[model samples]
Target: MFLEREEYAILRSHVHADSVDLVDALAATGLRWSEMAALPPRDLTLHGSRPMLRVQRAWKRIDGGKALGAPKTKRSRRTLVLSPYLVQPFKRNCAGKQPNDFVFTAPEGGAWDSGGFYHAWTRAVSTMRVGRPRSPPRPVTASPNDRVSTTSVTRPQSHDLSHTHASWLIAKKVPLPGIQARLGHESITTTVDRYGHPLAMLDDEIIEAIEWSMNPMAA
Candidate 1:
């Protein structure tokens, strides 16, 4: 399920203060929760000519629990361009911290493990979702402008934020290969499979392009 921009805003507002920026970053960068939770201050280049975030590592599952490992795939180690909105939150997180410090952290301090972050995500959704009796569950066929119901979105996981990010970019008409790179998919096939349905919306642009090619101002 995907969330419209305003819905994302409402979700962010309800998230606990410690996690609000983490949620914002996920929607903005399309980074995996592990990739994001492991980010260190040094990975953020906030003031450069090209403001971006480097995906260097992630918390990978292990026998006992989890550990810092290389990214999920070779492509997952790529860099991501950040929009203007992300800089302030990143800067605030990086303040007075060493290069090795986690950019986003739990309320008690240090990086957020998956379980801890999941609880935070669940709490925020419940506040806006279960609390609103009049709000209807999001129908499968809702129009483009419809607001997302956190409760109705089928038990949203923190990972959905990544999907929501891609949906936002698709709405802006970004190409599939571009979204693949931003999302760090090992192959374009993975991107297409996961996003094919929503990408159908781009057929209108494809038709317009074909029309342009078939005519040269009737000259």
Candidate 2:
């Protein structure tokens, strides 16, 4: 898992349903930060055995700014399994909300203000002091052509959570195809390219299997 045990504890304590949905969206779907931000409540299909979160578009960062656009690739327009743990909370958050609502909208009923999200992230990370690093400052450069103002306070890149989820799958011996599907990766190659290494158990399994196989001859 990308979150250390302590980090999970801190997040569990401090993060509300919306924040947890954000994390689950990343960990389960391997969506980029921008993709998560663009999630529409209408995309949630609750009729399935496992509810699916449809990703219709992803926000793009261009010319030093970001905005919603067609999905970067056809592969990006896939559905993801909404984890069971998140379903109830997500339902609660969406109670009486509009169908087109942004799933992780600000509590004020508006799209998340990036600056505010970063600020809240900073505050949350600050509370999780043990083995967790402080949030970094946002980088700023003059962009007179840019419409979206860059974040003033830098936030740590959160994609590490994707890596963590992938690693957990590999460590748990989940098949590659399954991981690729859950991650909504276009190909197993993408999954392998990003998180291909097996966990410590890979070697241990090989050695233990070898020993067991050889020991049978001694019986």
- Which has the greatest TM-score? 1
Residue 61 accuracy (lDDT) in model 1: 89
With candidate 1 superimposed using the best TM-score fit, by how many Å does residue 71's alpha carbon deviate from the native?
A: 0.2
**Taking the tens digit of each residue's C-alpha lDDT, what string does model 1 give over 1-219?**
677777777778889887888888888899988899999999989997789899999999899889999999999999988888889999998999999989988899877878888888888887764222235656889997987655433545678789988988898899888999999999999988998877888989888999989999933
Name the regions of candidate 2 deviating beyond 4 angstroms.
16-18, 62-65, 132-157, 197-200, 206-219
Each prediction's whole-model lDDT (CA): 0.85, 0.67
Of candidate 2, the 10-residue stretch with the lowest lDDT total is 148-157
Candidate number of the best lDDT: 1
Which segments of model 1 are wrong by more than 4 Å?
A: 130-153
Estimate TM-scores for all models: 0.86, 0.70
TM-score of 1: 0.86
**lDDT tens readout by residue for model 2, 1-219:** 255545555654665554666665566666777777777778887665788788887778789987788776777777777667667756766677788777777766677767766766666655654343344433488355656543333323466667766776787787778877666677878877777454454778778778988896743
Task: Provide the lowest-lDDT 10-residue window in model 1.
Answer: 129-138
